[model samples]
Target: MPATIRDVAKAAGVTIGTVSRALNNYSDVNCHTRERILRVAQELGYRPNQMARSLSSKHSKNIALVLSGFLEDTMLNDFETMLMKGIYQFAFEHGIDIAMYVINSRTQKEKSYEQLCYEHNIAGAILFGLKTNDPYCEALAASHRPCVTIDTEVRGPCISNVTLDDVTAFDELTQYLIDRGHRKIVLVHGRKNAMVSMERLVGAYQAFTRNGLTLTHDSIIYTNFLREEAVAGVGAYFRTHTPDSATAFLCMSDMLAIGTIEALKSLGYRVPDDYSVVGYDGLEVANYTDPKITTVDQNIKEKGYEAAHLLYDMLNGIRPAQKLVLPHTLVERESVKNLNELSN
Candidate 1:
């Protein structure tokens, strides 16, 4: 076993308290006793407990990245992986200790947001995947600690929100379809109480209205942001309303688009030729299909980077806290067809 503080104290012929004070460089300890403790600690290969040490300090340097999903599901997705990479990179570069915690909606019923922070000894937090109905969201708004929420529209006095313009992105996407002569488009969306979903719905409506087209309420399908759920939900949806129901499917996520393609294929349909598709989030898997999906690259990694920066700045008092919107680009691939040319 590695050396503990007890081992060092024994070797140095001092109490554990004296050994701890000497190792932590407390001034009250005599210089001779501190030197002896440190030398004995080195000889015994004693390393301080980081978690214990953090708890002891008044100003803990530890922060947490609060992700909202099961640990397995969170790591499996490309968006989450890329986001974590950006967050971890920032923490590493800044000499910050980052703790990762997953608190799904169900877990929030048992533990409050503040309780999680308290248990983890977190000084600040970067949160992601909180929907509108989360119970902790109310507490989060009232929190005095530094926090940055990623990709959500929720606002608070101290909480910084990092996201791209979801409304504008979806607006341009719908307009892109309308420009290409694609009318009667189906909008595949995420769950209810999702702020982003609401924003995207607004964008789609705005685009359709501006072009003198009506986006009827029946045209939207809610799938709750999972591929398997999307597959079953979309499959059942189109079964009731045939492929001719819409010429294109404008999905709020790549997973939804991919699932739509699968659901359509199982019913003996081809993408773009039979029904055009456009997805949000530029995931690599979206490109693996026979016809690559057109998508919006919303800079998810940069959102993580900005979230870290925002929370750190708030904690350090380096800058005032506010919403940070990052840039996004539309990637046009082989998914959406040019219906105008076909009409000619």
Candidate 2:
């Protein structure tokens, strides 16, 4: 067992309060006595209780990364793993403790966001996977706790959001397809309530409008951001609609885009030959695909670093900005074919 302040006090022939004052650099203790106490502490291998010390100073010295709405494989996904690496590195370098929590429907029912933070002694939090309409998001916005969210923007004095500029990302993606002479495009989207899905949809619409093209209501399909659902949605869409109806598909996520590719192959359709496919969220898994995926790289690690720093700043009463839009790039690969060549 390591030594405590009481043990150090006894060895140094001083009161526990005196030893604590010396350790805390209170200046009231004599220099000689303070030095003797520190020497005894060092000899006894006494390590201060960081948690208790933080409590005394009114700072928890701890932050939480909240992952909400995931039903399975909490940390196995490439995006979540990369984001967590950034947050973990930042916390380690800054000497702050970090706790990870996965919130699902059952957990949400058991504890509110504030309750979870309080129980964990978290000074601030970085929240992800929350839809804009989630009850926890609303509660977080109403509370004064320092919080930074990804993708969803919650309105509050202490709440900040970090996300890719979806409008610009998707606008560029759709324009890329348009520039290839693709006038017929299919849009595969995620959850309807998610803020990101809506933003990307807007960007897609803007691109089509920019090229003097109008998308009918049938051009859009929502898959709720699930792989199985995306496969089924694509299958169902093509059940009635011909493959020739759309020459390209703009998927809101790599997972969905990958599923679409698999579904097309299963139905004997070749990507970029029969139809081109584009995806968002430049997941590492995208590179392992047969033809590699063309998607928007959000630089998820940098976003995670920025989100953690944003919360850290907010905890210190420094409001950098209510919303931080990280830059993203379009990674072009073999998935997109030049429709102009086909026309020629």
Candidate 3:
């Protein structure tokens, strides 16, 4: 049989209320007593019944994670998947439960932030893929629930965010390509409203200006980050223009990069030999391509883990720093060749 709280209290020579306080991390209990109870509970393998505790405490001890796009959508990239894994792992460690709400046209309207909080008795929420003018963010802020956003920003008193430095990372990546003697680069980006896309575009432009290269409007392509969209976009471009028009292609995500490669092959154009490709989000898929894609490694899994812990801290009444920006690295691979070498 599993050990009970009462059993733990008796073993530790503490009152039932004291045991509860210690286990729940309530500050009312003395430090020495809390430590003693915790040690005793561990020795006896005492595990609190989470459901029962929630019922008694009137706090669900559960967090709601609202994903802004469908699982089948192109937005569900490696960054999203790894980030969710990190949230789950952190929540589990802290004895909290997570409920996921996948956002789509139907669910987005059906579920309101107020209704979700009231229905689930949620202690907090984590939002991924927030738009600059999203109504949900406004609602969440008004609800006054402790919330955290990953890869997006939200404005609220109790909300915090975790993200990468998109402009700097992208600028560095594009500059790397420029240094390799690649000119006439094509940029394939996501939705214009996405914060990341905007920041990346800024970085891309900075790279062009610094290198004294001209960035034409026609050189940029906007896609929904879908593999199909990437293929169709590149295919159409190649048909209307010449393969030699651009020496390298820059993709905002690995999924797009992979699609670009597929389309290039189908069109009988060789990667690196004919066109070099660079991708963001160094997903494992990047390495599997025929000529592996060069990309920026954003340490996605760690980002998730950190986001989870940050939210956990907020829930526990510990206000952590507002913005947590993780580091990024550029992974050099086969997809991009030094045009200088070709010139020489």
Best by TM-score: 1
Tens-place lDDT per residue, model 2, 259-311, is: 88998888999987888999998899999997799999999988898898888
Q: Model 1: per-residue lDDT, tens digit, 1-344?
A: 87998988888899999987766556688866865775576567565777456564544556899988646352278888789888988988987778888889888765667556654666789988888888768878877778998877566778888888889999999999999999889888887687888888888889998999997777887777777777787787776786677899899998889888888888788888888989998887877876899999987777788889888899989977798888889999999988999879
lDDT of 3 by residue, 1-344 (tens): 87888998999998999999776667687866875786687567565676345554534466788888656584546667777888888877877778887774345444556545544556788888777666676666665678888877776788888889999999999998999998889998876777888899999999999989988888887797787888988988877777678988999888888888888899888998888889998788788888988999998878878877887888787775388899999999999989888678
Clashing pairs in 3: none
Q: Where does model 3 exceed 4 Å of error?
A: 1-59, 72-76
The lDDT per prediction is 0.82, 0.83, 0.80
Model 3's TM-score against the true structure: 0.80
- Supply the global lDDT for candidate 2: 0.83
| Candidate 3 minimal-lDDT segment of 10 residues | 51-60
